[model samples]
Target: MSIILFIILLLFLIGQQVFFEVFQILCYTDFRLIRNEESEMAFDGIVVANLAYELKEKLINGRISKIAQPETDELLLTVKSASGQYRLLISADASLPLLYLTDTNKPSPMTAPNFCMLLRKHISGGRIVDIYQPGLERIIHFKIEHLDELGDLCRKELIIEIMGKHSNIIFCSEDGKIIDSIKHVSAQMSSVREVLPGRDYFVPDTMSKADPLTVSFEEFSSHLTRKPMPVSKAIYTSFTGISPVTAEEICSLAEMDSSIAAKEYSEDLLLHLYTQFSIYLSAVKEHTFTPVIYFNGSEPKEFAALPLSHFSNYMPKEFSSISQVLETYYATRNQLTRIRQKSADLRHVVQTALERNRKKYDLQLRQLKDTESRDKYKVYGELINTYGYNVAPGEKKLEALNYYTNEIVSIPLDPVRTPQENAQRYFAKYNKQKRTFEALTVLCKETAEEISYLESVQTALDIALTENDLAEIKEELTNSGYIRRRYTKKKVKIKNKPLHYISSDGFHIYVGKNNLQNDQLTFHFAVGNDWWFHAKQAPGSHVIVRTNGAELPDTTFEEAARLAAYYSSMRGSDKVEIDYVEKKQVKKPGGGKPGFVVYYTNYSMVIDSNISQIRLCAD
Candidate 1:
């Protein structure tokens, strides 16, 4: 009996393993239901549906623990689930409407905004019963159950509609009576719909689009063929949920051109397009989603909750959760946008100074070019001194043998002065021009140096990721006299630090974001034996690799050079020359500008500015 039982147990284990393998295969299988080259980053209806599906799995039955409005058009909700805690961020900003889950916290105002206070009062301890997407539309509805002020059970619906400038977050009773909204839109503001308090809430039939989920093949074909527009446009315009991108995907999957007029397509091709569209809808119905982000080079180009086959030529990064994709994509995009906006002032300052310096340099160059003739004046003086006695009193010009070039040359003369006086006058003019040329040469070098320094500052601004990073750059500009220092009772403490990365060979690499940080890293943080790198003859960050008493691997050296090239002004170049040397070999000239280092001997390498393989280490 014991042996029989052991055999049965072994069989059960085998069956369990096979079942798990099948489940994994089902989860990861790619369904190429859609394909399109024209991509978008905007969260459309299909994306929202995927998000709603994922959120329902993780957030349903979760309790609302906290509510905060970090921005005027954004809300952050902390929800506690049986598995763990999650933060849901929603934004209805006119420029960017977004919803995602994140672990990062944003600072809120001291006093909560009126909308935030209202949400907190109603849903502080509410239990989320259902999270759903209403009709294949860009809208999410959250059903919450909570105890009212009288300690009675109550229900409310929080609806978020993501319709570009018409986006809003509305609170309503379970019976659909509007209570309030984050943004109040009156009849005067929008003739289609009024989002004001106490108004009956409803989705406006502005597009008059048919429901994609319930549409039959006959209806789909008739609706699309009736429009004399591009096939892609007809699909999106006729359906409530389909975006131009999705429509294009359907056309591509059907092996049809999306740009062709809908009526121009044959009946067979139209049937094929409808078939492909239905396959995608079927995947949505089955809750089979694969969140993928397509990249054009290193930057994210587009993202979707379904497999994007048209991006086959480009790199496609897959994610397990739609929320993860949304969070990463938007966070990166937002960081870039914020950096550009915040760095605008600094960029203008640097550009202005660079333009002025460039103009001055050009003028000095022209002046110096004019002084090139000063040598001829000196030669003229010597020639006149040698032949002054032969010159006639009233001669307007003197002809002399051109000894310098072995050619005869004519020298203009001032007949008003004596021959001896003419020679003295030419010598005086020669001396004045020589002095001007020398002084202008020094000024030109100074102006060029200023331009290079400002360019480095601009590169630093581009590399800055946080306000603290900007503060450090701003302080550097002030110290360098490009910006005037404002008088304050207390000085702002500097908290920004250099970026740290770990090479594949377990070596620590440091990249300086700004000039001040570069100086500090090279002079103080780096050791004598550490490897220092910079882009040769370009404005860039100083990259230092710590040796730590070990022989440096060739790969580490190459990675350091790549980092130096990537963080430089020549970032977009196909290849850049990098100079590397021992930290002790790099020296700062006396009274030189920040980040100005002179190295007589260094190793040089030409490399592409790709450091995606290197891992960044948080300091």
Candidate 2:
């Protein structure tokens, strides 16, 4: 009886293996599974499936060691698994719902938030028993097992739904009773569902979308034909796991336009689209995910858990793990988002100053134009002095031969004043106008300089990636008198440093984040023999390449020039003219503004600001 049982267990295991092998073969054999051509970064249902699969592989059976809520909508969980320790970040932010594994740490508030404290109390030391997705939905379930107060094993379910503004993270008991959620949705907040404690946990089926993983071809064709909307809309609206990108991809694979109405497609085309859709679904079922990030030049355009053929015109960077793709994509995106949020006040200040200075500059230019007649007054005075002796007493007008132009001219005079006094009066007016022109010229230059300085500060704010970088920018603004400095007991030292990059030829290149860093980089950190580059006549970063007494390669010069263009006000331009010179040739003018430099002789090159090939180094 024991031998027969062993043979049966072996047969069952073999059967399971064969079934998976057959399924994988069927997934790869379909010729209709053409690559989809779509570009998007939204964490759709299919993306969630890929993430869930990765998490299950890396985090299952892992022990939860630490839990933190760095933001109101974010949670960071540190887990130790057989492979290694990993930090899993989950956020249900309305604007950017995200879930990924990361190694970086975020600073939390001094006092733990209420929801964070509650999670710590309940499942802080639990083990992740399973990670799964239900019915190809845009939700992940983390099944955690822990000891109760009675020392009995208790299971809990943590569900995370990525549904745009409706995204949420809910903690529930085994019986599907909602214990708490990161975001509480009352009836007033959402008419479709109410998310409160003691409420039964359920996903609202408002869309009535069919499950894509199990939907038959007949159902797909029927549902699509019923919709009078565009083909892309019909595909996403009729299927549970299909996003607009996925729908568009299906249409592209069928060689049909997504904008056309679904009713316009022939029966054969609809059948082809359904077959292609099934092929993609089969890949998801077999877990054959290819995590890729598409880039438009140096900027990340979009990311996906599967290959995006629509982004073929752009560069595709593949990653071994989906977590890595998410981490890279969101890290850059979040940095830009945070910088924009923090720099709003600074940007307003700079823009205000820029507008004021521009107005002043324009008024000064107009006033200077009014002084164009100053020379005419001087010419009148010269004629009066040359021919004043012949004027009769109480002469209201004098006619004389103007020697300068050799033409007769008329000069109006006060009848009560002598000829000499009238000449002196004209001379006085000439002197006054001359002084006004001189003063306005200087003021115009100053106003123009102020405008340029403010624009440069705006460019600096655009390139800043961290809070420390922002602090340095704030300090620069305070020093420039754009922002008022508050009274403090101690001086705030700036810890922001320049962006460091290594050229392909091993040359070290440094880019300044702001004016102060520009000054520091071009003056103190650089030697006389080093090379300097900046965008010609544009507000941009000062890029310095350390020569170390060696002749720099042409590639290094091109790379530095690219950096200068990318970090400047002309970033979006197709090509920017960059001026490069030796550090010794660059000079700071006397009483000039910060980052203002004069270089009489320099080599220039026009280059595109695509620095994707450049490698950044740690400072």
Candidate 3:
């Protein structure tokens, strides 16, 4: 069981490592996923502008027919599209940018969540005509035309401020009367617009360098070299919207080290670098080979494609345009948010169980000490066997055997007494230390299996495109005792699946695992004349063979013995002792663990657990 847990932990760590590697790759590519869209926009504006171009065309004039807040930091808008009905999700939230489609809508309370209500009041039914961002400034604006309550056609602007530490969406009328913001700011917070009622609104100032999309090789080199920084740092710091992730990506595409100092480049090197930069810009503009980045963990620390906090660690100190960073931030933040939220409960459960199990294991260790001491009982018995009644009674001393000059001996004892008595005494001492070790072992095995099963279930749950698939897992869990049954039901007799197999000579055989199964397999399913098999000195499954008037074969008897071994805890062991007899001789103990049976006059044999070579029949 401990071995199984170690395997599980190793697998989980390996999975996390793989996930982070993939995340890093995805982060470096032109993929829109950055750690935080809001901060990215504030830091890398131009990137957001370019991204808006891709979305504006598809969404312009689209009716805001549906709205949903899938998460605290996300919004999904359903619009009628020429291709089909399309869902546009805008994640301006600092933490996660999330947008997706759903055939079924989520339930909205009488009052909506704050973000949801803000969106509905400001943008609902509005025609999204255009989306734009200032050159690399970490801000985005959506221009919409919608009818007022008075039925007048009016233009409203929803300004999404992606500025670092000041990200918000402010809604305003054409005259710039503040409607409401997703997040309210006060004069106490910043000199920027407070986003309060009747507050005047205007675009924030750009605080960074010149644009990348329009710069020439000489100007680009001149501007970059002036920074006296690494090429990656120069590009990221000089641009408003270029995150370090993008800067590094650009350098990678240019086939150069991003960390190389810009001042170290010669004129020819600068020209070649500038030319490649242009090519990369053009490729990005054309949407060629959009990359996917993945984050993976190393042995000591987990690596994220974008820093887990995209703006703080992963973003460059300076950027061309804040808008660009905003776009990447939203994309990356959304991905991380989803992964973290979905896996949160499962990880918590596993970690809590592991801690509890560790404590229980300590108790088990202390309890086993007394058992270790009593193993010396075998040594005492051996001494008695060799020296007989000649030795002093109750002597704990290890006396030398044979002559003193040549040999001294304390013989190894192999006891053949009833193991139950030794085991009971050992357990009594173990129980004194902790009564819960037995329960802990059971829970540990069960928890390990459950965690593995749930990991598989989560993958299935994610892909459940239809209600039926979702219901199956829910039903399976409830039925398997993970959840309480909610529905009322009439009590029905439960029928266990029979472990029927065909012997080498064609006789029908059945093996039972528990007491209930044993009763059904022996008394209800098998004939009285059928043969039975079980372990000789240890508790195990009840196995029965139906002869049907045919003479028994020795080969069949051997196959039955193998089945008994396969079902026992010693299942992979080389050999196990099994007792066989006619079904007539076996009787259930009046009060014992299910499968406990007393039998007279049985044949014994040692057998291995390779019984699959013998044919099996469910019927």
- The lDDT for every candidate, in the order shown, is 0.86, 0.86, 0.58
- In terms of lDDT, model 2 sits at 0.86
lDDT of 3 at 195: 69
In the range 1-619, model 2's lDDT, one tens digit per residue, is: 9978975776587797775665554453232122111112568788899999999999999989999999998999999999999999998876677899998999988999888898888898899999999988889999999988899999999999987666789999999999999988776445778899999999999999999989887899899889899989999998887888778777777778889887887888888888888987787999999998876544577887777665665568899988899889887776777779999999999998898889889899998999888876777778877888888888899898888788898989898988778878888888888999999999998898888888999999988888998999898888888789899999877777899989999999999989999999999999999999999999999999999999998899998998899899998677899999999999999988889999999999999887767877755
Error of 3 at 200 (Å): 5.8
TM-score against native, each model: 0.73, 0.74, 0.46
Deviation from native of the Cα of residue 351 in model 2, angstroms: 4.2
| Model 3 lDDT tens row, 532-564 | 887665545678888986778999999888878
- Local accuracy of candidate 1 as per-residue lDDT tens digits, 42-156: 6778899998998899999999999999999899999999979999999887667788888988999999999999989998989999999978999999999999999999999
Please report the TM-score between candidate 1 and the true structure: 0.73
By TM-score, rank the candidates, best first. Answer: 2, 1, 3
Measured over all alpha carbons after superposition, the RMSD of each candidate to the real structure, in angstroms, is 17.7, 15.6, 17.8
| Residue pair clashes in candidate 1 | none
